[model samples]
Each structure stands twice: as C-alpha cells, then as structure tokens.
Target: MTLHTAIVKTEENKISSEEAKKFILSEQNGAESIFVGRVRNENSGKEVTAVTYDVHDQAVIKSFQSICSDAKSKFDKNASIFLEHAKGYVSVGEISILIAVSSAHRDEAFKICRYILEEIKHKSPIWKKEHYIEGNEQWLPGYSLRPKEEIK
Candidate 1:
C-alpha cells in the first residue's frame, strides 16, 4: 500500500478532490472512498467571507503520516491513503481538504477515509482564522483528540 500526504501553503490553487481520487485509483483496490472538506459560507450563524489556515507544515505532515499508519493498522494493511490540506486562504465554498482511500473492499475504504479525516481534525496542528462578512475575524480551535477510551 502507498501513502501520499501533502500540506499545500500556496494560494495558487485549492485542494482538488479529482486529483486525489485519480492518484488513489488502482486496479488492486476495488473500492475507493473519498471525503472532501469545504469552507462554508457561514459559521455559527455569521456570514464568513474566507478562512485562512495556518499550519506548522513539518508537524502536520508528521501527524498526517502517523494518521495514515494508524488507519492502515486498524483497517487493511493493503489500503492506500491520500490526504491533502490547504494551508493558506480558502474562499467560501472552496475545497480545503481532500481524503481518499482505496482498499480491496468498501468497508475498509470507508472506515479508513473517515478515520483519517477525523484524526486530521482532532490531532493535526492546523489553525483556522475565519473572516466575517462584517469585517470581523476570529481564530477557531479545532476539537481536541479523543482519549483512548472514547474511541470505538
């Protein structure tokens, strides 16, 4: 199984779900599951104009690799994982993250894809600052990693 992970800090482009899907396509893997995260137009009832993501690139990459390893261990060792996250400004309705997993069966692919996304949200050191349409801005904290007992 192959693992591809990236933290893109450039504003030249956004995370592409198609590209991720294309990269994860393999003849050996019959099932491919994908999860795409997009910047919402509103958050907590406030209209959001954009979201700027700040990340410790090295640390996030390491965390992502570890997440992929965990997924492999928990799911199928032969599954392939592809994860990508945007590090700069993302406009409303734009893609911010892409996760793709391929495995021999649908169940493993689905579970691994979900697990990687959840881990990224909880464990990765990526910060997001939301810009409101009214010119207000605020940094939001992501959810903390769940304890071992909390994980099923």
Candidate 2:
C-alpha cells in the first residue's frame, strides 16, 4: 500500500530521521535501503547562505504517491516505501529528504529505492532557490516549468 508520501511547506523544520529508521526496521523485510539528502555549506565555490524550497501543492504529492503505488505492483504487495522531503531554509548537515524501502530480497529493494529518488528529482514539481553568500538568490537554471514542458 502507498503510505506516507508528503510534500511540505514551511519556514524550517527538523525531519525525524529516527522515525523513518524505526519505520523501516518495523517493516521486517529481508532487505532494506535508505537514501538521505543533506544541505551543504558550500556550492559551486560560493559560501552557502541557505536554500528555499517550493513545491506545487497537490501535483507534487500526487506524483510521489504514484511512484510508490507503481513500485509496489512490480516488486511486491508488501514492499514498504516512505518519503519525506523538506521545504524552506535548510542548513548544512540537515536532512533534506529521507527514502527507505524494504523488500523480500536485496536487489529488488535497492532498485525500487533508487528509482523513487531519481523519479522524484526529475518528475516532481519541486523547485529550489539558492541563496548565495553575496546576498543574491537564484532559482536553479532550467528548473522552472517552461511553457512547452507543461504537464498536459
């Protein structure tokens, strides 16, 4: 079953990595994998100021849910999946997103977890704006939805 797929919007909040860890353990599968993203102190030779995240309210979340549902069909009905992505100002070493998946075997769990992470980065309407040390902010180039790339 697809469960705990979420996109958040706020100033800043701590993501409970331990909660995710516990959930993964409780699922009790033969294999498990986790992906953890962190905010860094430096980027492109610039001192990192902070990152601002903005995501399409409904569409991004629906996309997340769909990823889980489809993975379940291929892997196993008991395939456990979870994702938590952050929004707003994030500092270095803070968790940006946590993805954990478990399956009956090692290979299937690894593939599903990796697939979900990349699919989220590519397909979700989540955008990030970089705050540079020079007191300038810029949205990631080529990330803004172009007219031609509308999800029609």
Best-fitting candidate, scored by lDDT: 1
lDDT of all predictions = 0.89, 0.76
lDDT of 2 by residue, 79-134 (tens): 77878888777766777788888788888889888888878877788877888888
The collision pairs in model 1 are none
- After the best TM-score superposition of candidate 1, give how far the Cα of residue 143 lies from its true spot, in angstroms: 3.9
The segments of candidate 1 whose C-alpha lies over 4 angstroms from its true place after superposition are 144-152
Could you report the Cα RMSD, in angstroms, for every candidate shown?
Answer: 3.8, 2.9
> What would the TM-scores of all predictions be?
0.90, 0.84
Lowest-sum lDDT 10-residue window in model 1? 8-17
* Candidate achieving the largest TM-score: 1
The digit string of per-residue lDDT tens for model 1 on 23-94 reads 888899999999888999998999999999999899999999999999999999988888999999998988
